[model samples]
Target: MLKPIKRAVHFDFHTMPGVDDFGENFDASLFARQMKDAHVEYINFFGRCNIGWSYYPTKVGYPYPGLNGKNILGDVVRECHKLGIQVTGYLNAGVHHEALLRHPEWSKVNMKGETVDLDPQKPFNGNFFRMPCYNTGYADHLLAEIRELLDLDVDGIFCDCMLLRPCLCPNCTKEMLARGMDLSDEKQVTDFAEEQRRKMIRRIRETVPEDKYLFINSLPCPLTKDVATHAELECLPTADGYDRFVSQVALARPLYDTVVYMNGRFQCCWADFGGYKGKAAIENDFYDAIMNGASTCLGDHLHPNGMPEADIYRDLKEIYAKIEAYEPWTDGTRFQPEIAVLSTVPKLNQSHYGVGRILGELNYAFDILMPDGDFSKYPVLILPDEITVSGELREKLNIYLKQGGKILSTGTSGLMPDGSGFALPQWDFAYKGKDPMQIAYYKPTFEEKDLIHLPWECYEPGILLDASEEDTVFARHITTYFNPGYDGTHFNFYMPPKGETGHVAAVMNRGKNVIQVSFPLFKAYMKTFTKAHRILMKHLLAELIPQKQILTEDLPITARATLTKGEDYTLLHVKATYPEIRGTMGVIEEHNVLPAGRTVAVKGEFSSACLLPDGTPLVIADCAGYTKITLPEITGYAMICLK
Candidate 1:
């Protein structure tokens, strides 16, 4: 069963035993009332903290010494159950202070022959938490604690800090040797780490019931396919960058059915009394989460006295009220994607994230697809830089292309899976070796001629290919004078091109509509957010997939747009909020309002158009190939419905 966790809170209370009075002011009735007032439907309370202290009476693990035999978790769960608010028990998976004190051999050993509890170079301090190996006796203790937690009758269990790294501990080393795995090879180490993670997840699944929610935090990661039902992305915009929220959602949305963007109220993570962001910032974050088909969760830390912060709840009341109002259109709607971007490699793949960000910023509905995902629904497929074509994937692409599909590839995307050279008969291009120099310039001969920026830096220059006479040459490249080192910069900041004209930077086959670029455009844009690079990509996409595109008048690139369809109506979410750097972090400070004359092009036919939340009538017109609807005066976020 899917829990009603749309508007939720994550209470991270990693309190130490030195704090004597635990949950002294925890009035169960008052806490439940506060949560209800804040419009929270689900809450994740602590079962065990990182300090190895359990909140409830436990037979497998020691209880918090400061609890004085009181069951704080029991009280919270009992009251929340009465109020119809689901509770999820939270536990620290890896770190334990008490376990470190008892068994030193179980701790993780680094290359320096020292335990990872503290930096060996510094003096010994009592402030750091220790991580234990999962292949040792600590795994048994963890399973016992998980069994005790499940017996508490909570709705779910959220395990935190479950990381898998190469540990040099005695037990881990022995297990690696017994399994005949060599530690020197990085693939072997990574395989072992994944094995350990799978083992831990399997053990936890054996203990918890199948009906309950079991979330494991692996930081902006996808759900372990068969083991986890939902995926939670820890999207703290202040701690990390604000761009990560959208990029992470774009990556995880295609992998899991239930993806929650877990944001925190604090300015930073793990800060007990941290500063709160402005109200506009919080609302912007929630809107972004919902726009990408994800649930919303706010992170907070409970005080040592167990008293709910009155001001925090008051602020959340207003923000969550808006979310509740938008739930009708936000939930149970299918995202209508017209373009699919394929992921080539698993790691070190920057172009995948870069393409998603650019496409999202352009207000085009798209999804990031893995190699195995279905591409039949999408009319346009984008193969980003460095995607080598395997035999299996090559066959799939050939079939997709035969269905009159449009394709856009860059760099060495059409190369063989072995990374030796290009795979012929895949696309119309002859492999001529890579350019010796690093920096290059582009001059567009097709649309968007304003993208001609002189002396642009091409970090990872693509292997130059020969264009046929039947193909259309979109842009031509300009070779550089010298090769820039690994830093992607050269001593000559203003180096000129080798000549005014060079090889073709962009080309498109006449009949197939398959476009290829001579340089790594996505990687260059990722390195430097140049307008020229984006314009080049946008121009190519417009030529490839122009019939089905989102057309907005006078909308900035920061404004995001997504179109989704319900059973009877279609929702167009247009979010216009810009995050600027404030106090060493980027925060949404302004809720820019759009004028009444702004128009958005909708794809489907509808009888009527109206503003959401209130069915105020709006004028709609039938354009050449799209339905044009005039937008209202939107402040921060707006959802227009057409039926």
Candidate 2:
């Protein structure tokens, strides 16, 4: 029932083969051959969406002139159809095509009203735009071109780059005026793209019929992460932008949670613009992306007559095998709205933005989302710090709250973007320590202690308030600040934005039973409190998922449980940084397969997939959210049992 996109082959035109076009590295024959060789189920490729010129021979737009080649796209379509493969057309949503440069008026402009081409000579920079998504005449023109392209009888038309934000154009200004949002300030431009994004999705959906595939290469929205009638592709950058963007999409980006609100079948694509150069990197990326609930799509710059070298093809085949072997399954329940954050992006201080800590550590557990929207899908939206939010998302958040949702806004939240009246939360107290406290607490300890002082956040120290004001309260604690006197929003933990003092640590909502916390719940409160943070996280989890009585203690650090019908299995993977292990900073992740001390518990007999934890009796984990069994510190292994 989930029409998810699992595998896709991407093709880029090297150059137009016609006499009018200068480059001619690609042709129809080469593409068909490569796609067939790869054994791809789907195909995504970029075609020129220029004002008048066309990649294929079109009546309205001339093909690179003076050429008499069979329409390359036409041939590819024929070959692909013959081979039972699907073809989708790619377009630019933010910037104009090469021909649009001739009319500066149609170019993308920044806040200053100066129009500039993303590429004066070419349209595709692969990095998307520095501007926002909405407010461009190019979208209109792109629509015109798409209407023509759809006539080719392709299976679907993929509208790429439509969700790219941050463009300042004349039309954008006019559109903003129409929205009653007149602004001259420069910073307001950061989120101007999201509005247009909604427009772009709407236009594409309307233009395309109900049954036609209308793919919007979008991050998040009121949009569904899973359900796209038209397949979507993310043409992410290879190096810096790849993981961040892919994680955003796979984990359900923009503003929505993975759990409570995900729209089903939103196919995820991991872009590798470099093609063959960074194949291992590509493989690793796809693995992580899929693990986080997404499919894969690789990006390559188009050139005529050129294929992504032999190595690229070979690497693709290798990864293909890996993906196929996994036999991944998602049973409908995975599609729900859940909010996620990078715990990383913004640098509150000027120096930290580029040099901030990497988000790769928790990539498996959560999503690294963009700053344009408010995630309503999640029952609790946890902010590590203040982040860039758009006004559009603010409205969405208002809707979510009005419908009875809760948010755990922590650190220097509400300090970043989105001109909403929302204020950043403040912790009344600070907890002091000599060294950065190791975040450690087991499931057993959590079940016993039942509290956690989460770390990796900005905090302020003081007395607390028990009075339930307009909003109900859950939990709060005091902290002692060591490196005191650091002013101007200083966060004690590793952060892009530093909090000064009196930051919001953790709290829950009494009304909707919504709860939010800062960072990984074990850093501050429970870790240092009378109880451990693991205990606190269990409490939060219990509060969030009251329906499912998940046992907090006796579970692995990287434990994941999948329950279906009357059977269930808990996948337990040791964290790379688990086991405070006294002097050991963090464990090497690869050690999971080596078989450390592990105890197995389940509802049914242990299957052949597992080994006894040092010969402990394997039983069914029939505890709370099921059962909790003692297990080795593993990051990617599982405990299988039946309910």
Candidate 3:
């Protein structure tokens, strides 16, 4: 789902040679023409990033106050905008030790209560950066400087810091309290951060055009950028990135898809996926993001210490050749579901039954979304075997449903609240009839208009393919294998062979809409038949309020996408991970050149033989078709010209 149509390169010109001793000899007009010639879509002029400094003039504050005439941002923006290359100047929100020294009151106190300076002692130990108090006078001053770019008709604003993770400072705590929240709990603190970030985005939105983007470099706390045109995350490969998983970094993909399905505002990711040596790994990470949802401004920093190396730039050019083709993958189907199901979550229903699997395999259509209240955003609410919604939320659900909105509650959906730790214990009691904790309960009625009566039972080695209306299923072509001769089937429900009873699973239909429910855990069950994530998705498409689901195959899996095509051609991504397991990968042939090897293997999976622009191949994982291909490499992705 990480495939994105729009991309921006962070031009870290910090170490670029000055035009003159007073910042002149660097040939301004000439370089602007050079940037336009680069054919780049967007370039964020590094006015100030990486630490306490400014590339442009500022009357409010100045570290290099002695600098004389020429200003960098003004020159770049003026030249680039005329050449059709959008420009957004950068501002290091945090990270320079020198800035902290200049604005002592703006500095942050760590857990040790020590003030940190953004500009550290010259040698650099990474210790100087700290989270500052946002409600302070310094932030106001910073905002004032940022205001200058808006006057220049900048395409967007690049905020280097101010993350979705909140600061535990006094101002932050006070603000949280004022917002009907607390700072003690982690989620609450996170919520507070998200809320504040949202406000930041709102402010930026208020400042620019609806199409302008905002790059909030906060990682874990990135949802605030949800409402912006596009958002950015920083340093996924760096020390503070998605802990280096680059692939599984979580955010608003699951939760926000309901609103901005594809090419929506929730598009953002940290460009910081560190350095790449090979053309393969580089293409791998790049396309993997495209397949998932977004690839906005991925950090391809050529140097660690700002020393731009020739070899690294070569790699960037090669990778860029491949990444540029991400546009084609952006035009497909859009999946905006309503009834989001809660998964193997730590909290949920405590008293259901059975050692269960196959909710989706059962052909149930439960919206695969991250439930974050925005539940109100959806008209009807469906609760399946997962767990019960909190009492307060349950009460809200009851109200919404009673008001004529349908509520699909099955299994032990409403058995109890979260405080009791009702997740597994309760679920086991309902599905299995007995738990080691001696928990037990009557199974939920499979009785519904959509489900037909069929004698079904689970198997030892394989799970059930028990899904209904197969035509509607999506990309269930999972190469994720369970080492052959793998003992123990996940869940196989013996069916009555062929009948209406055999086809339908649990379904809730309102005269207005129908919601299908399913539980397909491919990791637990090795058999592909048992995965009904698609059968349910079909229901989401035709029944649960019109949704256009795009799939490379007919079965559904953890990997999914929403592409905005035809109109502008963009791809939005949402991805998840599987338990430790690998499967045979698939490689599709594109391009005129066919290599000698049977296929390229990425992280062990055979690659799709499509030639990326730079000749690197597009390799998709066997498991869930996780993949990446250079956008320019594939001719199929070329923009179709209508007569």
Candidate 4:
């Protein structure tokens, strides 16, 4: 098995030209010492930046003019090697400003037959302004740079910005035409672009040694898992918050042997030199990664002077000290999820984010899975929002269902690829077309009325379905009096619920193992955190899964709980820190503590129960095939072990 990256730092150095005094104040020994103090075991130093300038003296690429004759990359590599810290050479593969300026023919042309370049008005706004076409001579230039980094004796290569940007360059156009592909078709162009990227990855994988690590950023997991050594999820919470990170981690954990969660140290995002996320937020990010079965990597931009930031390392030292203490329990543990959510695509969508957030907030242990992922292990599988059941996947799911697997499918999940009808016979519903009323309301049945009393408004539309006579209806669809829209007369601002349409919104089969909801509840819940949606989901889960992994009482909705199993024990991780929305940014300034007297019940019996790291014993009892324990006051994070 490959060794997981526990503590690492990604040092970004995308410096522009005309910068003077580069590497003038660099002390190789001091830099290594600072990393050692911060407990960093691995580092990704800049080899070739987005500006197409190498930090080391190179023959294949232009050296940074500010470097003047200093081989900063080599010096840092030697120093970090002496301290047993592994180093990977970083290279910006897609965007090369200097190369594009020197060779205009290598630039990527878009569908409009126009050369893709940075906005002339805001050229310096982002680093990915001008991208080079891989089908051109730029591919050879990129490969030559990788060889140079290998010759420099770096431990590995970290290639960045390797996304699929469809190009219409002469070479790409010729190749597509030769393959009889229609350039006008968007899907064809996208597939061709993905093939080009896969070719580049294969070439890079061949260049790097099998033993050495090679990570390609922005490559979708399980699709490109064969070309890379491991997976790295780069998520800056300030920009998109923790939902994306959590969803990506859940998708990658089951596929890769080693997965690293990379988050920035900057308060806003990358390249914010004056910004810092402070100790509490950093702790929250790191612990969240660890509990989700991924190692942590902090993102920081190195100063042009080549010296480490003193204040950032100081804060890192304090935060990493706690991580080091908790490593014993988290080192080789595997996430124990009771439910598997089938992901519609390699890249996560709104449905993925919504389902992940709802499951996480509800303290239900679940993992995001691909269509081909194993389904037999999980007691219940969720097809969220937009998953179309393919023929091969339909066969696999049929076997799983025959073996007593429960499924909760929503919206267009169980539908056939052609939208004819549901592929699964267990659904027990006939698919009519989409509802004409885009927005409607949901009314629960009399039996489940206590869960949600009144009609809840659904902003998204649902598929029209007619349930079989044997099916049990949990909720009914209630159309709106009229969709809020301008009718060329007076505009309708208010929409009230009309009478029930006698059509089922949520239904279950006679076996009670398969439940299907007509609407896209997960996406709606993610867009609008409606309490009734979550309540309805919880009610559905009660019927699907009678015994949950972790049951909590008196716990705040903000708190998150995950279960993991180690060699000798089962660990229940609980995190209680909530991010405060401050002017468009979610900030965590302080850790909130939950008072004692909260109770938790873990499924299965254990010999003993105690708190992690400290080994403090907790009172435990057996209740209905579950081991119940009373949790002490927990601040920030807590791990309970049952062995």
lDDT of 2 by residue, 293-355 (tens): 446666555443344555566667766665554433332213122334434342122111111
Q: What TM-score should be assigned to candidate 1?
A: 0.93
Model 2 TM-score (2 dp): 0.60
Candidate closest to the true structure, highest TM-score: 4
Off by over 4 Å in 1: 117-129, 345-349, 449-455, 485-494
> What local distance difference test score does each model get?
0.77, 0.43, 0.40, 0.85
Model 4 Cα lDDT, one tens digit per residue, 1-643:
3456778999999887776777778898899989999999889889999888999989978999877777777888899999988899999998788888898889887777667545667534387667888888998999999999988888899999887767888888999999999999867887888888888888999999987888999777777688878888998887778788888888998888889988888898888988888878888888788779888899999888768779889989888777888888888899988899998588888888888888887788788888778888999999998888877889988898999999999988899989988898887788887888878888887454336488888768988877789888888888887766899996787878887887878888887888998999999988899988887888889889988888875578888888888898888888889788898898789999998878888889977888988999999999999988888999998988889
Instruction: Estimate, for each residue in 231-277, the C-alpha lDDT of model 3 and write its tens digit.
Output: 44343221312122221222334433311111111112223234332
By TM-score, the better pick of 2 and 4 is 4
- The window of 10 residues in a row where model 2 has the poorest summed lDDT is 259-268
Model 3 worst lDDT window (10 residues): 258-267
Residue range 1-643, candidate 1, lDDT tens digits: 7754679999988886687666788887799889999999989899998888898898878788877777778778889889999889998886777776787876776545567545465432343435777777888898888877778778898988886656767876778889888867657766676687778888988777899998877634543646766877887787776666666676676778888888888766555475777678778888888777888898888887877689888989998998898788777887778888887543325676677667876776777777888888889988888777877888888888888778888888877866566664646667677766666676667545455546555666677777777888878777767664444554555567776444788888766558888776777677777787777788888888767656874577778888877899888888988678767778676687877778888876777988888888888999887888888888998888888
By the lDDT metric, which is better: model 2 or model 3?
2
Model 2 lDDT at residue 536:
45
lDDT of 2 at 313: 64
Who wins the lDDT comparison? 4
Q: What C-alpha lDDT, on a 0 to 100 scale, does residue 639 get in candidate 1?
A: 83
Evaluation by TM-score, superior candidate among 1 and 4: 4
